[model samples]
Target: MGSITLTNIQKSYGAVHVLHDINLAINEGEFIVFVGPSGCGKSTLLRVIAGLEKVTGGELSINGERVNDVSAADRGLAMVFQSYALYPHMTVRQNLAFGLENAGMPKAEITQRIGEAARMLEIEQYMDRRPGQLSGGQRQRVAIGRAIVRRPTAFLLDEPLSNLDAELRVSTRAEIAALHARLRSTMIYVTHDQVEAMTLANRIVVMRAGRIEQVGTPLDLYNQPANRFVAGFIGAPHMNFIEGALESSNGTHMLRTAQGDVLHLPQSVAPGAPITVGLRPQHISLSNDQSGFAAQVQLVEALGSETVIHASAFGTKLLAIVPGQRRISTGDTIYLSYANAPLHLFDQSGLRIATVQTEDGHSPTFV
Candidate 1:
């Protein structure tokens, strides 16, 4: 296992800068996932770490040594790609043995490593098959097995599961997690799927528009986002947003939505300030009563375990995840309320204000 540090790392393609002030320190044996929308530069950052993309500026240190000028083959990192990238004509055994062969290892050593990797990946039965004869999941296992045989200090996976089926995706996710636990090596995963990021990473890095927005564990990013974008991006059904204005007290907030209704809050907030209130779908409690915000059900999706209720409220559509067998139909009026503890408040500028008091007993604030 080895630690990785990126200081002021940057990338550009002639005038369009893709990464800015990218500073991060990853501990040995830690699994860090990079997540963002397409064109957000997640894959680019992983390539930078693997020494595949040349950084226009900044320092990269691997295992305490600067590796900005190191070649990809010498970085002691193995990369697995979405396409599997296996040679079509080579057997599974050959695919795993190719890299070690290039390094001029003994034939006995290469054979031993390939045997161990095939056993670990449960592909012993397919050792003689070429990429053309194997299924998608099998091919991916071969790709991972090739990485394992190298015994690299760090493993870099760039959407390695994107090509698999949904069911296969889940199975491979578990396998990857188990692989990490067994190897205990530093790993970096880049993907646009939040589920992959949340399930695999010990910590998550949320990026947007070529910049890092927040760095935290899965629950940290879920419960406490650093900005509006992070808050909206990390949640499953996405957080509900309500436009409002500053109320009577410094912390108290009120909303007069376009649906011709008013909402009063107990917390103190600045008056006359335009703000946005965010609440997760799971945080909301739906009821038949009209006391809280009233909504007309627009659509209802019933999964086996839970139901998703899409309703029209305050002149906008809102989604509520109703747990367990409860069902609602379209055009049904429903009430929505949730605890304030999970409520998110964003300023007019889209920045987050601290909701808790400071350690010195001062009021907690984001401003």
Candidate 2:
């Protein structure tokens, strides 16, 4: 196992900078996930860690040793890319043992490693088949198996589940998670899928436009985002933001909506300031008795375990998540209420002003 540390790390192509001033410490045997949209420098950062891309500045250390100028092979990290990157003509067994053979391991050692990895990965059944003969999930398992045989200090996975179908992706994701639990090796995975990030990561690194926005545990980021972007980006249905006037003149913070409605904030908010009222779909509950803010349902999405109600509130679209097939309808007028405190509060600059927890704080995440 190995630990990874990045201090003020940066990357660029020509004059365009892609990653800037990244400082992170990844503990040995931790499963770290880098998640963001396309062109967000996630892959670029991963490549830099693998020594596949040169760092323009700053420091990168693996196992307490600087490897900025080291060759990819010398880094002793195995990278599993989105593309399977397997030898098409070779059998799975051949592919898994090829690297060891090339490294001049004895034939016995190569065979032993291959057998052990296959048993660990449960791909022994397909070991003799070519990549073409296996299903997509099986093929992916073979690719992972190939990397496993190397037994590197760290494993770098770049969207390895993207190529699989939805069902296969689910099973394969669980397999990967279980693999980490069993192997207990340091693994860094990159993906644009927040579901993958939320489920697989011990720590999720949220990035935007070439820089890291925030890093936290799944629920920590979900419950208390650092900014508006982090709040909206990390959730599945995303968070609902209603433009309103912030008022804290009374003992409690309240927001007056544009359509002549006032919603009480869960935490203290600065008075008489312009702020966006953010309520996640899950936090908003529906009441037919008109107890809260009035909204007209616009659409309904049923997902078996929960129903999502999309409505227009104070002239802005709002989403409310109701538990278990709520049997809601379109064009139905309903009242909404915030189910919790700790609402995400952000300044005009998009940085969080403070959490609902305190009267004064710089970032919501600091709570």
What's model 1's overall lDDT?
0.85
Distance (Å) between predicted and true CA of 347, model 1? Answer: 1.1
Per-residue lDDT of 34-136 in model 1, one digit per residue for the tens? 9999999899999999999999999999999999999999999999997989999999888999999999999999999999999899999999999999999
Scored by Cα lDDT, where does model 2 land?
Answer: 0.85
Which stretches in model 2 have alpha-carbon errors above 4 Å? 248-253, 266-268, 357-367
lDDT of each: 0.85, 0.85
Per-candidate TM vs. native? 0.94, 0.93
| Candidate 2 local lDDT, 224-305, one digit each (tens) | 7888888888988898887778766446666777776666654445588878756678877776565556788899999899
C-alpha RMSD (angstroms) for model 2: 3.4
